[model samples]
Target: MSRAQPPIAVLVALSAVGPLALNMFVPSMPGLAATFAADYGTVQLTLSLYLIGLAVSQLAYGPLSDRFGRRPLMLAGIGLFLVGTLIALLAQSIGMLIVGRLVQAIGGCAGLVLSRAAVRDLFDRERSASVIATITMVMVVAPMVAPLIGGYLDQWFGWRANFWLVGAFAVVVLGFAVPLLHETNHYRQPLPGLSGMIGSYAILLRSPVYRAHIALIGFASGAFFAFLGAAPFVVIDLMGHPPSDYGRWFALGAAGYMAGNFASSRLAVRVGLCRLIQAGMGFMAAGAALMLTLALAGQMTLLALFGPMAMIAIGNGLVLPSGNAGALSVDRRRAGAASGLSGFMQMGLGAGISTLAGHLVVDSALPLAAIMAVSVAISLLAFHALRRANRQARELAARTRPALPKAA
Candidate 1:
């Protein structure tokens, strides 16, 4: 690892590309459907498939970056992002647009995976968690701000305007990244090939603590992705609200998430990861419960839809930084692989939930609310499992330790 750590701002910009591309174009989904004369399900593939691409590509990126170092892979990924964004901007058909999104996801995920690995390289567990928490706090701004820009761009210019802006943003981030980001991976382990990668992942999966952390990360994120998939359709198409209105309302959820991350950044080291995680999950569960109750009770206004989501966002913000730190800490030697696998689980579940929610939330937001509730429930169970596993390991260690000789 280079003694020089990259500035937090650079890391944020690098990481923000993925979320920016993901959220900025979301407000244009309805327009995309109208332009291509496709059904909503088909149009929704752009988001779901992009998520799947992020999931699958991270598997390779983590291991490859671990072996090759971070800077080069990150640059390559950003280059791919630029190319994909260009293709998307110029696409003539929905199929082409989906293809472009997949490419963008594959390339963009390089930054996401490497940035976390870089942090692990630079800091110990608690400190890394703190840093990641701070990074996420700032990074949340991208998704929160992106929708507003996306909505206005779509409304004022067209669907293509959003992609144009994304491309330009990527170019600027790329310019800064090339100069500032250096080799942060100081320890490079030998991964002979594909089998080595699989073996690394297997070792991580065998650990109950690691598995629990991944579960928490995956399902917690699933709640939000489900919302992203369904909310645009619910607000814009069904509720007959404009895209700008959807963007404005969506800011509430983003702000809540930012607040939660701010709390995590301050409290993670002091309060401990597990407590923070539990508290965050409590927020998530409550949010989902309230949302489902509202939907079942026939409260389908904008506040009813977005307000509970704000609560869920706060929970996610609290859980994610700690979850990532806990998982990466499991085997610091395999931090890259751990990061990759965790991201895979997170995005894979998200892709599935986003697609499912898009299909089910056609008539009402009840299905979306129900999905969030189930996801939050799973997250709570995962945190419980993590606590149990940690307790068992401690008990086993105590039993295994040799008895000390009595003092004379």
Candidate 2:
């Protein structure tokens, strides 16, 4: 690690790009629809396509980063992201804008996967969790402010200006990344062939611990993804709030998330990541259950919905960093692949949940609350499985310790 560019800095820089990609243009969706003379659903395809591109490309980026080194792959991906941003800025049609989003997502996947890999590269399980939590605290600011800024830009300038702003941001990040980001995968040797790469992934996928952690992250993230996908419909559409009001509501939820991330950073070492994960899942389950109850009772106000939603967001902030760190900790030498696979599962599951929830949008809040509750329940199941696996491993290790040498 370079003294000038620490792992934490790299994680921050990389993770920051994700929120920029996802949230910076969100407030412009309505403007974009009018600009292209398209329906809202057609315009929303920009989000859907970006997510789909991000999900599918992680499988490719992980293996490539594993084969070729983290720094090079990350730089290349950012370069692509920059190009995509420029394309979107110059786009004159809805189809062109969608294409740009897909391209941007393909590039953005590098940041999402490689940043986690870099953390696993530099730190052990506990330390990695702390680092991720800290970085997440900083990264959450993008969502908090991006939409606010985007709304102002759309109001003052035009929807195309949002893409121009993103392009400018990407240019700045690319400049910073070129010199600051160092290669972290010191133990990664390039595999000889496709068979070798496939064999390596097969070996990693065999680990019960890794799968358990990945599942925990996937479902936990699904809760937030469902909220992200459905919040516009439930809040701005059904609840009759202005679209600009999204920034305020999202910022409150994001504040809770950032607070949880900060708390996890401080407590993961003392309480243990496993314990934190279990506790976080419990909080999420309880929050989702509350939201579901309110929705079912026909008394779900916006505050009622957003209050538990913030709690669920906070729980996710706690669970995600720990689960991701745990998954990557299972195989340090294969950190890139592990990070990639875990990112694949998390984003893949999030995309599915978000898409399903988007389609289930109705006049009532039931569908959204139902999806969130199910996601939390699934995450709790994963946490339980991880706990049992950890116990079994401890028992097996004790059994194999030669009966403590009979010294006692």
- Please give the CA lDDT of all the candidate structures: 0.92, 0.80
User: What is candidate 2's lDDT per residue for 10-78, written digit by digit as tens?
Assistant: 668776776687887776775566688997778777777787788778877777777787888888888
Residues 1-408, candidate 1, lDDT per residue (tens digit)?
428778888888889999999998999998788899999899999999999999999999899988989899999999999999988988999999999999999999998888999988999999999999999999889999999999999999988998888888889999999889988997788764988899999999999999999999999999999999999999999899999998899999999999999999999899899888988998999899999999999899999999999999999999999999999999998999999999999999999999999999878889999998999999889999999999998899999999999999
TM-score of each: 0.98, 0.93
RMSD of each: 1.2, 2.3
Instruction: Give candidate 2's TM-score.
Output: 0.93
Query: What is the C-alpha local distance difference test score of candidate 1?
Result: 0.92
TM-score of 1: 0.98
Colliding pairs, model 1: 1-186
